[model samples]
Target: MRYHACRIAVSLSLALPLAGCATGVKSQLEVRPWHSINEFRDQRFADVADPWEGFNLGMYRFNYYLDKYLLIPVVNGYEFVTPTFVQHRVSGIFNNLGEVRNLTNSLLQLKGGESATTLGRFLTNTIIGLGGMFDPATRFGLDRHDQDFGKTLGYWGAGSGPYLVLPFFGPSSVRDTGGLAVDTGITYGIYTALDPFADTGHSFAISAGVASLEAVDMRHQQSFRYYESGYPFEYYMVRFLYHEKREIETGKAPTAN
Candidate 1:
């Protein structure tokens, strides 16, 4: 009787953790067992359609650690050392530079009004605002129409593919990823064509330095941090919210059913 009881006790202990981990599925098991692995996964993550949950979860943890240990400290130091006015100027410069992307995308989307407004803002800010250190164009009533290639693709009815958690860029879809590459290529080509630093003979160094500053400024402007919501289901929530937000902004329905 003692040996039989020990075996029962061991079996119960082993089953308990698996049962706890199964959560909602265990209750459904009473009705019927899962039909397939896909069915089991679908039920397990019914709240979010995360087919790549394993990889996405890994990237999420990686981003959290990277932000906490490296990016946050660097951004903090930048903010601490730089004056507010200087920071504003830096942001303005980057915003001015981004107008190229905005203008190109606006043209692609056939947004005549937005393209004109973006062009006016770019010219006004670059020439008058001294390379976008100031935003006199906003005061002059030429509002910025921030557009990107991703939105352009969406505008043309391109479906957002699977959810992706990029190494540096974080949450993005397959369509957006491709759009980003195209936009980046366009910008790089334009920069190469203009070659503003050609005369200095240190174009590469100058470009690298500017790129680094732009990266830091970008990080400084963003206020989001990983796990900041204090929710256990933050990953699923973020994934869902990102998809919904993109759908609304792009006016394109998700095609990844």
Candidate 2:
């Protein structure tokens, strides 16, 4: 659970800078391609009633409270102990998870026995070799990578269905939502060997803690840019960059505006 929290914190740190850059670069780049994608999604978005959107917004508000109170403090406590190591380990865990996701998606997309073999090796190393404490794929020259079902669908020439802000989950494309389900299943299988109740509580605590830490890290990084943009823009900009970063992880070029 601590490991998971660390991963989330690290992801947010990396995400903040990338997101900041995306925002700055937004005006300089032509985003027509992505806009087209967005427009297509907007049609689907409209099919859902505004009340549902409002409900999602309300849930987001609740998440903010969780972020501020429980999650943030736990991350701060971890930071006070060993800032650098904690940060690195957190980032490494996050990257490692991404690599696993990528490997899975890549196999699903590419469909090769060799890919499955490599994925098995990765799972073995991350689970047993690392004491489940770290992911060594990057160090082993496997190259940290990730792919989601959405990217797989895109590779197969399916359009991104829609843009949706899921409550608590954040920004996601229609395809990615399905990808998340598969990923969660994989995660569940991996974690199921442990005691169920204890593992569940620990995982939840760690996730909350990591998110809080990430919010703190983002607050620090965004402080300098706060004067340049309002909170809403900053928020959306962060979401856009995180989503795009995931796309990049799946081996796609940054989406054009």
Candidate 3:
């Protein structure tokens, strides 16, 4: 029973980062020539390296339903009750906390400049911005530079092994999934260390509540809706785009033919 409870907790944490990096695609269905679903799927995925296509597709559909039925409704309720200023402040706090992950990964990659910038941003936001309720770092020209353990691995020549649509987490590669675990561990450690309620018996409950709020804020910041792209082969497009975007960001973009 404990094991199952732990599994549920883990799943909820992993699934909260939905659509954070996804881009919406405008449809060409009205103007494009007709083609059967099979033909379109086959043609678009012909050269893709998704060996887990069947599993990935199933998970993709599962995520769509999960977002539609569970996540979005909660997000709607959060927006309904919270004022806009409060929403932005919540988002800012989370983003400021994210700088910890970014700073760690940048240092791992030996990116001296990026590490310094990230550190500066964290200090500036936390101190001057009042617990990250505002972003003063950007105004000072210390732009937010996001980094992750996955990108650090890629920088050191680790390949993105397979295309995967993680349950609740959405699109990821094998490398990024592992990176996510490492980054999550880092964030969890910070939460534990800085927990103001640690001396109180309610630390666990407070932590859970904060985590839930962070998840909702993440979804609130995202605007992409599944299947709203209006492309018949959206799964294919998203898969391809995800791979390409990661490659470019990690400086491993494929050479032009």
Best by TM-score: 3
Residue pairs in collision within model 2: 31-257, 32-257, 102-146, 102-147
* Candidate 3 or 1, higher lDDT: 3
Per residue, candidate 1 scores C-alpha lDDT tens digits across 1-257 of 01123433453355345535666565666645333334444532244446687898799899899889988898899999999999999999998999999999999999999999999999999999999999999999998876788889999988888888887678887888899999999999999999999999999999999998998888788877887654345566567566766666676534656
How does each model score on lDDT?
0.79, 0.54, 0.81
- Per lDDT, the best of the predicted structures is 3
- Rank by lDDT (best first): 3, 1, 2
RMSD of each candidate relative to the true structure: 13.4, 10.0, 9.8
Number of clashing residue pairs, candidate 1:
0
Question: Candidate 1 clashing pairs?
Answer: none
Q: Compute the lDDT of residue 129 as modeled in candidate 1.
A: 100
lDDT of 3: 0.81
TM-scores for every predicted model: 0.78, 0.51, 0.83
